[model samples]
Target: MTVDTAVIATRLSETFVAEVTGLTISPEITSEFGRSIYEHYLDHKVLVFRRQDIDAGAFAGFGTIFGRPEEHHVVKLRHPEQPTLTYLSNQDELGRNKEMKTSGQGWHSDYSYKLVPGGATMLHGLEIPVAGGDTLFADAEAAFAALPEARKEFLRTLRVRHQYRWSPDRTDPWARWQYIGPEERKRTPEITHPLVRRHPDTGRESLFIQPRVIGSVIGIAEMAEAESTELIEELVAHITSAPYVYRHSWNPLDVVVWDNRCVLHSATTKDLDEKHVRRLLRLTTHGQPVTPSMPKVGYSRLSSR
Candidate 1:
């Protein structure tokens, strides 16, 4: 299919998806362009644009049209001399595989580990594997709204802990917290947050627990663990249910922007040995921290490995 470069927004109503065509914004365009993009992001949750010809510098300049760009916390920052982009390939600078696990494989909001989680994320696909590398996004707001009244009420008063530790069975002990340096880990250890998060700008609640990092629901009794687990799983199921979800098959030059506050996304894996490499540049928006005054909910953070 031919992907056009003109700025066009098309909605995929089947899954509440919106695609914006011809995403390459000229460096000469006024800063208002970025603001317009942000407005669309808030309303649509997902924006897809095509920009095959623009280079990294041009992409960075385009990002500035939305808001101040921040250094990616996990991914290595792009070079100072060329501030326009960062490489997102599996291969390292030496052209060797970094063996970096793709973080987007599971459903998650971008950078929820941080005190200020990412608000939005823009990913430009530089290269794409032929098949099975599409990214899927689920609308958390829609998920929350569809919850049963009892479920919503219960979650509103509960809190969950978020940390960097991986699942005990899946993670190597030595590799525990390996994603973050000691200093960074200390600065931002497991923090408590409401299980249901309210968007400061939109005043809408979203299911905010990070199932991977969250240890347990605070104040829940030990005997109730089975019940708690079942309930949490149900909530996740609701969030990822059909009609509210959309999967985007990647194409070279496709740039997707999504609101981290309201969407949960995952990437499908492709063959590692394939000659073609998949690369993308991601830019994330920052989120405000949840305060104690917001709610009296109990939660527990897993021990630091």
Candidate 2:
């Protein structure tokens, strides 16, 4: 169902969801919309726009106003007309179902595994099935703010190890760089970052480390890994707690643009056996690497093939 762009513009609110209006064209309106998106991104980590009739190229055109879109070096499948648009789904064009886990199943920042992670991400839903496949986003800024004073103090001075190749189960070969290439593998297996980071634009402290990718807390006792892991897990739990998050149930023409720097997100499980297909075109925004003095943490450079 198409929505009125004017109505959406008038009623948009910071506390609740708002559908962005206007045809996916017009240079003047698009520029204003891009700035609005940036402001909303800083205020609300998740923003959903419904009924945007955007093809891959059109979506890329809208995305370019915000920032240069980055190609998914690992996810080779992209729209032929728009190379910047990464096709995310469990089905192919011929109506045949492919494997699940097209990229969003886990709770993560877009490319936090990389030395230079993604800045923002735009996902336009082309196809969506019934009853499942909603995306959940957690506000890391809110999560960090809610931490207990003692816990915050402890985390402020710590650093954790992160790896691109790390996964919950050693099943997906694509999850590892060895299967991809040595050049790609160079950035895999490990890097270190602060437990707490100050946002480059906002200068607000946030929980920087994520689970699984973080091997252990640096300079801590080896026997303390279990304790450290438990502590981090609790912190993540606090971050994902309800009221600090929003879930977006999709419609075919829905488009979502999110800031990766301050939010963590994941996709809900869907019925893969019923020939259900969920197709989305995604473009990522590039971000500068977190600096040392900002947090005084050690980070080793790994290869990105």
Candidate 3:
């Protein structure tokens, strides 16, 4: 598709998504233009911008329109020139992907374990695979809306625990990949957030659970251990059903952005090996603190190895 003088947005799915075209993001982008894009983002939880061939810096700049771009916790994955942007590639320095595999295989909302979670996440597809490497998103807002009134009430009164590294005894592939040093672990402590999160901008409640990746409902005083575990498993199954899910296949130069507040996403490249390489440039925006004590840290210098 060719760039146009005006941007165009078309509904991708009624479940909730929009495709944006004809806009080129640059240093010259005006505030009005950025605000318009954000309006579309607030309306649709996911926005697919077609043919965005911008570099990492420009991609990071585009991410700022939604919120302040934040550096990834993984220091090695940070782009050299644009530190705010990170690489999600199945390749090493020598371009040999034989031993490399994709990350974020489990469904999760980015930075859900942090004191201040990520507001939104944008990915620019650079290298795409032939068959796999697709991304799946679940509509948390829709899933929460579909729940029974009694269940919703119960969920609203609950608080769930989230930690980047929850358990130390687990021996899984993700555990190896998600390993953090003592300092990094200290930076991301186990925090409790409302089971049902109300979006700051839209003021809509959504199921805020990270069943696979980060944490579980462990802090609710009223719920027992087995009961909380059962409740989390049941809700995860319900929230990820067909009606609330959207699978997105990648295309070269495509920019896909999703609201981290109300969406759960997972990478579908687990079965893929180095032979089928997939690479993406990712930038995440700063999110507001869900609790009173968790202050927003826009940009912080954390030495990580």
Candidate 4:
């Protein structure tokens, strides 16, 4: 359980993931040390730092080492003292789980509909469910690499539109929970991003499909809506295949950082116990707006959202 205070990165799974240890992360940080921590994040798309019983200030500090920590558009869940961290808690007002916790019920890259979708999200586990409530992540890069050459070429030319609002068929409790203010709606609107995203820093091509929030795909003028839906279904299935996936079981003192640009994650909670609740503090690092024109591979056919 206890380890040396010298920074170490240990691979957790066969896929691109590592368990980070031996570093004390705090608000007042050194750039030299932070850069080394970030290098591990770059090498491993997901990093699990365990037994880091740090406060909110320290969590936000670790987040900024990668980039500027962004406030959640959802203002209600934000920590009073720290805007950068959001409390993903399941308890209702009186410390009971009478309400549904919907922050990450389905697989998604955080704030993907935004013009500049967030980059890396770090979550510190304040409390976790014993039986379930694990978070699962899928590697888009590996999924794309496994695709057939013809399918890869076709996807490169396509664009997909993502919307933050729930679909018409989504009659779940989250339909009301996800509501934003009228003025806020203007700030967050449907945006089209390349189906195949080129990572801004690495320039690595990834199968960038946010299945839960996707409204539609453009650029395939001849494709019918029904066929497009089927295609998207297939893409989601392939991207989340077991080979490219890792399921993380949380420990109370564990903190996990996942790159939203390269990974898709979902919380796995089959059922919640009303007796106890799950809670976590999360900080997000914002990335640059995705440019419509991807010049790396010369694929730029897109439609206005």
lDDT values of the candidates? Answer: 0.62, 0.63, 0.75, 0.72
> What is the C-alpha lDDT profile of model 1 across 1-305, one tens digit per residue?
11333345678655356776644556764254555565556557788876556766766776664445677443445645454355666555523244443545667776676667767677888887787678888888777877789878877777665665534343654233555567866776665666778666555667875345322122222326566666667776777778778989888888787877778887765344445578787665556675322442342211111
Best by TM-score: 3
Best model per lDDT = 3
Error of 2 at 116 (Å): 1.1
Give per-residue CA lDDT, model 4, range 1-305, as digits (tens): 11324468898776678898776667544354776677667667898988887888778777887788988655776788899888777776322243336557667787777778888998899988776788999898778877889988888887776666645344655453245566765766667787888776666668777554432223223457677667777888987888888999898978899988878888865366645568888898887776442665533222110
- Go through the candidates in order and give the clash count of each: 7, 5, 0, 0
Question: Per-residue alpha-carbon lDDT of model 3 for 62-134, expressed as tens digits?
Answer: 8888898898655776888888888788767523243335546777888787778889999999998888889
- Please give the ranking of all candidate structures by lDDT, highest first, separated by commas: 3, 4, 2, 1
* Between candidates 1 and 3, the lDDT winner: 3
**Candidate 4: where are CA atoms >4 Å away?**
1-6, 27-30, 93-100, 168-187, 212-222, 291-305
Which portions of model 3 show Cα errors greater than 4 Å? 1-6, 29-32, 94-100, 173-178, 181-183, 212-222, 291-305
Higher-TM-score candidate among 3 and 4? 3
Residue-level lDDT of model 2, residues 216-251, one tens digit each, is: 122222327677768767877777778666788889
Report the error of model 4 at residue 168, Å. 4.2
TM-score to true structure, per model: 0.79, 0.79, 0.85, 0.84
RMSD of each: 7.6, 7.2, 7.1, 5.9
